[model samples]
Target chain A: MKQIFLCKDRLIFPWVRPIWVFLPLFILIMLPTWASEILSVSGFGTLGYQADNRSDVATIRDLSQRPKDGYATGPTWRLDSRLGVQIESRPDPRVDLVVQGLAYDHYKANLNNTITLAYAALRPTVNWNIRLGRLGYDAFLMADYRNVGYAYPWVRPPTEFYGWIPIFSVDGADAAYHFSGSDGIWSLKAQGGKSQVWMPINGGIGGGYHFKTDNLATLSASWQSASWRVKGAYSRFTSASDIPLLAPLQAGLAQVASANLPATSAQAADLLQHVSLEGARISYTTLGATYDDNTWLIQAEMGHTTATADIVPQGNMGYASLGRHFGAWMPFFTFSTYRPKSALNDTAYDLGATLNQGLRDPSVYMANSTRIDQHTLSVGVRWDFTPRAAFKVQLDTMRSHAPGCGLRSISPTLRTQDIHLNQLTATVDFIF
Target chain B: MRPLLTLLCCLGVCSVAMVQPTQAEVDVIVSPENPLRTVTASEVSDLYLGRTRSITEGGVSVAIRPYDMVDGLVRDAFFMNLNGMQINQVNAYWARLRFSGEVLQPSHLPDAQAMLDTVSHDHNAMGYVDATLVNDCVKILLRLGGGAHVPPSP
Candidate 1:
């Protein structure tokens, strides 16, 4: 993947604008005549709106988006809106070529993030599949398909589980072995690759961070019956976080450590590790299951992520949802939560109090910088009004616990506590 | 009592849904060159759901090319017989697999006659159509229904 700056304003392909979407649609109609045997084109999009609410903190769809207003000015459409087009060419039974370009509120308005997926697969035999190129991660249950709103029940997948971890696509290779028997179908997949992503900072006040993950590896297995599926995956990756906002803190810690003061030497060293995210190793393990009996849909997933760096918080997140279909309408309910393994580091606070005067403490904010805790209860309904389209409206009541503001972009001014806020969101999703 | 009431309401909806418009019998037809004489519903459903690309028939793994029709009624009836699924569930199921592009969906033809034309030309190709329309060009691998379903004629 090419390195793109978080503030790079230049479009990689200036001429490839939104108008170019029509060019493919025109080509799709004429394609059957030109290369009907090998070519296929399809697309999906969501027109969404987040209803206004009084939020003490700046709410974001995920870590990848920066809402325009830092203070809950009004309703936002870019929070949950996206359009994607996929082109697949299968010239032979054993070969597959796919390129999908998605347009969303990416951290960087660049083509690298716009063109999300481009991969090729080759089937050596009936039971073996080998793929290479830029592929979506198959770590979670809906990690790859979450962008396609029409494919899932909710307006968006639970943000607690997906917001903090934004590495969606990896540029590398994977192999899968599939076999089926009288009981069920089973598959084993192994993936290894490198990935780069820019996650947003403090909404509009702070910018974003461009981080790269090296030696990313994942192993996943699944067993599927006619109406039930169980999947589990384990992944490990190492990332170095170079945050410009925390540069002052890092330098301060380094200065204190270098001085070798007896009282603050160990504290400085530990706080330096807390402030710097260099050579951070993160491991994510997840287990998920789904049961869709054509009449009822039930899904649940639990994930635990651990990191070696104190700056990178270790945590657990999970969600369970149930939905039932009645003709063209489906009503659903979901509960999701995220709990950090450890609260704010007392060592950072102790060193910060030591650095600052005992009266006003900036280290208190430092202690609360990465601490996030929250749980949400959601009720939603989906109306499949047409064959190719669906309209969904969901109401989510969130409780942002004290000492943390969940996954919101963080700052001293926007730090909210133990407050409840209700958000209403609606989306019309379609695929063609 | 509340749980039972909820279950009763769900059963009532199911009972109402069971009353659907009658259609014709859909025959899962494949090329006569295919080695397998017949297939089970799960085997056919697996292909339709984009689960497996090939199946072992007569001790040999044979790659399959499934064909779908533009006629919505016959298509719905076929899946309804294969698995108790409506068209929306089927479409959403395929949509979930669309991003990976790992699962190969059955190519869509204009109508059943076009399906027959394509299936007859390829030994691996298979399709479903009105049982009355079956001819010597393709052999019946499975039968999905016995309704009076009339598909778009050639």
Candidate 2:
């Protein structure tokens, strides 16, 4: 009993947990003093819902809320809201300081807490700006701040492209520079640091653990003309866990149940080492266009990503939307889709190789290696009741399908079953 | 009844003829030294909406201020001809710009006299008021495309 107590005590460390809560507050309290001169505050939020057609799994129409599969037996969708305030201080004619705070709900099985976006930035020239702290990752065209509902033409972005990469916020440093072109404005950005990311929850027993990274780097460029905007970005990412070792062990387990091979500990350990998938290098490109004319507003976007590792499937996604303005109301509709590549081989393995043929062992299968297609259709309305305020309502219905061969052949029934889900959301957005 | 109606028509004509013809006219003005003689309605709309910053003879920056929301003369002579955007839509556009720190609302002028002072002082200024108030201080560039300017009554 004494040995057991010491063993547990050695692994526990409670002192480090409080620092995460106290550090951000200490910095926030210090801000209103030295930096209080030209402080300007701004805010944005979205309140929405999702209704799934399948009973076993509820569709997540709203990306802001917790997926039902990830939470306990509670409401399938609740008020997924976000609110942020930012301050901009210009001490001199040539220099300015910016600090921002963002809070949101992260619904887990038995957890409800608001994540904060604590970041600061400085700008000394019209062409150069630098920022540091817990901020957003530099993706192709989306601004983390501007990604709120008030800024976009649709209730949500097409899940096909924006949903594929899954990495959202970066807690690091970023710098950008802008130049002029005959066609429009051109800008370049480079960011690197430890990034915090979350992916869509998997329905399997154990899924979607909070993904953390130590080193993440990205380079991006954007150009905007009168009615068109295009952007391209590349990112290199690495994580603490090695994924290649997990895939084969899962495949081996699947084969043992069907092929009557004995499950041994040594066999599982060997397959884990041979099939470990880890450390991804990903590249992304995105293009968007909008026509703001007399009677209608139309927008379209397309994006694609290729990754070196099989952890994230290489794919392309896009959407098209149109909005018509009447006297006091603007009604719009959109459709978006995502497609994943069908193959997953690391250039060293063949279909009939020693590793591929050992499915009866406990270490050669991955659940997400197969090809899948997801699409969503949404209709929404925006009512500009006053000059400073607007109300929006949107409905999205989603459907997903997977191919029937290769890895999917290992579980034909699970691969062939297509599921449908729906989400409905409403928001009152304002700017002061 | 027919005879009575004819008598009233005659009486109306007599009154109209006896009264001095209050001459009502409309004109568009710019700087006297500006080389350009004419511009399209779309160009005026762009300037007023703050969509474009420069015009042919205008400087890099331009300021557009409607006389007032209550002014019938300004609406008939200027805004209606450019685009059908009502007063509310323009207000919404300005609100969006202000929050984004893009642009500010144009300065408002009270009457034709004040408007004349503004346009005459700044070469980039554009506005419309009573045509009868036009004087040598500013140059009238384009006549109102249509007829008599009684301006719609409130």
lDDT of each: 0.75, 0.51
Poorest lDDT segment (10 consecutive residues) of candidate 1 chain A: A13-22
lDDT of 1 at B50: 77
Off by over 4 Å in 2: A1-37, A61-65, A68-79, A107-117, A198-208, A240-277, A343-372, A403-416, B1-154
- Report the Cα interface RMSD of each model, rounded to 1 decimal: 5.3, 14.2
Model 1 agreement with the true structure over A1-432: per-residue lDDT tens digits: 123632231264222222234335434543563455567778889999986467445567766777676545367788889999997777668777777888988677777777666766889888898987778887888887888899889999987777777677877788999899648889899998777777766675677788777678999998888999899999998784567777777787788778887857676666666556656788999999999987899999999998766557568999999999887688999999888876654544454454754311433455456666788899999877665678899999877675655676545654645757788999999888
DockQ-derived CAPRI band for the predicted complex in model 1: acceptable
Error of 1 at A253 (Å): 1.1
